[model samples]
Target chain A: MPVQDYIRDRFFPHIWCPGCGHGIVLNGMLKAIEELGLSKNEIVMVSGIGCSSRISGYVDFHTLHTIHGRALAFASGVKMSRPELNLIIPMGDGDALAIGGNHFIHAARRNIDLTAIIMNNRIYGMTGGQFSPLSGHGIKASTAPYSTIDHDFDIMELAKSAGATFAARTTTFHIKEITSIIKKAILHEGFSVVEIMSQCPTYFGKQNKLGNSFEMMELFKKNTRKIGSNKKLENKNLIERGIFIQKELPEYTNEYSKMVKIAMGKKNER
Target chain B: MKKNISFIQGNEACVQGALYAGLDLFAGYPITPSTEITELLSIRLPQKGGYFMQMEDEIASMCAIIGASLTGCKVMTATSGPGFSLMQEALGYAVMTEIPCVIVNIQRGGPSTGNPTHVSQGDVNQARWGIHGDHSIITMTASNHQDVFSVTVDAFNLAETYRTPVILLFDEVIGHMREKLIIPEKDDIELIQRLKTTVSEGVDFRPYLPRDDGRIPMADFGGTHRHNVTGLFHDMWGFPSNNPKIVDGLIHHLVDKINNNINIIAKVKEFHIDDARTILISYGASARTARHVVENRRSRGERIGLLELITLWPFPSHIIREKCRNARFIIVVEMNFGQILKEVKTCIDKPEKVFLANRVDGVLITVQDIRTILRIVQ
Candidate 1:
């Protein structure tokens, strides 16, 4: 099927700013769904409030544009109640790690069957440019005019440690990797986390003198190396990009189904 | 027929009522006085193949149930004063999205974490105006376990009928106290199932468009009719709309859907109100004490009666006006410092006649306490 088949064309042009990386993430996501041959009726795209969250509105799937920081929580409910549906949750860096941090970690801990795509732009693009949890130290934002004192945590590491069965990281510069990683994450039976390093050229780019969208994409290419690449030995600070964790764990809904059977059996005995 | 009766806590009774009302999903966080509902459901839900989740916090619980409700599941969440406060934002989201779900707030002493184990009726106003918006909500309460069971079923029915969140506002006393509840058979009580859109696949399905009966028929999340659901003011297609006309129409529809149907929504139990000179208005656990006082005073020929409110919001002003029309004294009995009393005053013709008899120090308002206030007012 064509990628346009998975999009709701009437809602476009999307509300994302010019040269915003969120649009690339949305394009990659739709291509992934198209490549996987998933039906629109079986896919539920749940998103939180941000430029990235607007992806739910643009998609042809069953969409839920929820409150900030609670997409995973809402997706958990949808997936648990209807286990046959595929849940793809897209969230902004601030929407995922700041207000929604607690729910994010808890959702990973449950190992619920959800594909959480953290569109990490390192800044709050929706409410203008506020420093986010993923905004590394010394980055200037609207809320942090003097540059940030807070350091950013690695989302892949956080998700893995919080019990996510599948964790990966990619950048919008690697468009093919974004699509492939999202496809794998969706196919994973357990909780999956894919942090796509998207760009907010209008905010994080201009505020920090990172030039425009092209320059930011160039930075992503230069700073990140494929995981286990020999170039990582030359530069210890180079961010590694690849699937970090992919193993089987008991998914929440699947385990709950077995428990439900046992519970019913016990009730019959009573 | 063999009677199915169980002497259980009010929280357990609420669970039975929810299951009876076809509740398929429950997400809750443990809080004092309201934890039993969560605890009981965790054991009972799975036995019936229903899903129950103890979410990280109250906000997640509220959001989760709203998500489940969108998938055409009858969903619920339980909390107390502090937890309900945490759920306010998501509750507003549920209101804007018109998700059919039930929220049970077993009231404890409030403002902050005032009292976790004791009863208070202070959340009466909060349930109506807690979510920040020009919107109306359906909030019901009950004085005993039997009423708790029936009212909980009514809450789900109202939620599905209107495609809105229904608040079951029971106090801590009613939640924790044990009482006898006679469980009705499945066919004994009427159950309102979710109304789904008949719009077929490959056709446009407007999820927010109300029918002639003023109900927006829903399409499940994983169904063939895929549409957007957002907290922003949206059009019939459920896409975010900043259009002034769309915004104006959506807000009016959200408010008027519940407020305009107050006659069908209002539920109250009247005792000796026909020829009474003094009428006592009360709800939740406090209504029990008020009923005892009314019965005692009526035996002494004091011409007193009790108006036990089952439905608290949209305030039931017409019923209050009609019930208090012939009464010389209308005393509002509750456990808060004049929460319902303020509403009764606004609804009645004689505001001065509407006096408040309340207790707010974490103790359940007793019959004698109401009598002392009645003596002073009479």
Candidate 2:
């Protein structure tokens, strides 16, 4: 399928920075959706406030660009009512973890069949360079100007433990891997989470003394190891990328429907 | 399909109203004074092939209903004071984005959980201006169980017609009390479905374009149009824009849509106001006491009247100005400490003419309060 087929023609040029990884990830997302053969009317792209959440605007599907940290809540409503509609949520680290942390875990725990794609750029890119809960320890940020001390959350572990049926990780640098993993997440029957380690050249790059946009992306390729690769990890601190959790559980809305059916049938019998 | 007159609580009547009005989804959180709404809907909606869900919190509940509404479902959620407070942000989102949904706020005593089981009309002002930003809202108050059913049905229709959020403000006394109500059957009841259109997938469909009457036709999301929706100041195509003219036009449309058609939005019930010296103003449960006062005064040969407001927002200032013309005194009665009185005080140039008979001591305002106010004013 042509890449332009998935893009909303009138929405360009997108509002990201010159070297931002969002556009690449967005391209991968579109390719995944296109290759999967989902029609525009059957899909709904939901997003919350952030630089990353703006992807919904540039997409041609039925899009909902909602308030900050509330995309999952709104998408749950859409999915619950029209369970046949395919729902996808694109969230930023701050949108997924900080303000939206409670909703993130709850949506995972409910195992509602919606695909959540978290764009982890370390710093709050939209609101300047404030540090997020996903900014690694000792990372310099505008809010943490003095080479500050703050621990970051492991995205896969969080999603896996919170009952996600499919939790996977890939970087924007790995375009083919990201698209393939997103496709798999979309096909999963329960809540699926995809955490893409996107580079923020304008914020995290300049703050952490990473050489430039090219170097930052290269860092992703250099410092990550796939789960099934035959190479031993010499560096213990390197990020591990793969499908961390793939277990089928009764999806929330389906279970709710069955419960309702039984209850209604019993009431009718009584 | 004759009227089924049965003894039921006001909350139950509201549920009946929702069903008769073609409600497809109910999303709400259980709160004191309004828990019965959630309890009944959780069982009733699924049985009727509609969707009912008790969300994690009031914010999610508000968002959920708005989401369901976008899919062309008539959605509703009910909550009391504290829960209503949590819903203010999502309510603003609904207003800004032009989502149609009904919200029932059963009044309870509170700055913050002051008294959960008790009744107070303290959130009347909050209902009008609770959500931040400049926007027009429609709110209706019900004084009894039967009115709760009728007003709730009307609220759904108003929301559907205007493409805006409608608030049904019911006090705790009215919400909890059991009264004999004549619930109209689904066929007999008036129902308004959202506007529908069939445009091809790639056709140019502007979702926010208003008709000559200023009502924008709404479509379900999965429909052929598949338009983009956002909460920001947006163009007719539902995409964000920062052009001065575009934002200004969009902002004006939000208020102008309802303001231009106040004749249809404002509803009131007037009694003996054509020839009277003292006028009484009230709504919700407090209007019941105002009625008793008006009746006693009329029997004693005093030409006192009552203007009971059924529709409270895009407020009925026209009715107030007309009724208060011959009335030398305009008194507002409520269970709360002067919420509706503020509207009455500002509705006319005669602010001094507006008197408030208020009680927030967790007790129902009796007819004696109105009589006491009349004696003191005289």
lDDT of 1 by residue, A1-270 (tens): 898888989878888999899889988988899999999999999999988998999888999999989999999999989999999999998898899999999999999999999999999988899999999999999999999999999998899889999999999999999999999999999999999998889999999999999999999999999998999899998999999999999999999999999998887542
Per-residue error (Å), model 2, residue B303: 1.9
lDDT at residue B303 of model 2 (Cα atoms): 91
Q: Extract clashing residue pairs from model 1.
A: none
Our tally of clashes for model 2 stands at 0
List, residue by residue over A201-231, the lDDT tens digit for candidate 2: 8989999989677899999998888987744
DockQ of all predictions against the true structure, Cα-based:
0.91, 0.69
For all predictions in the order shown, the interface RMSD in Å is 0.6, 1.2
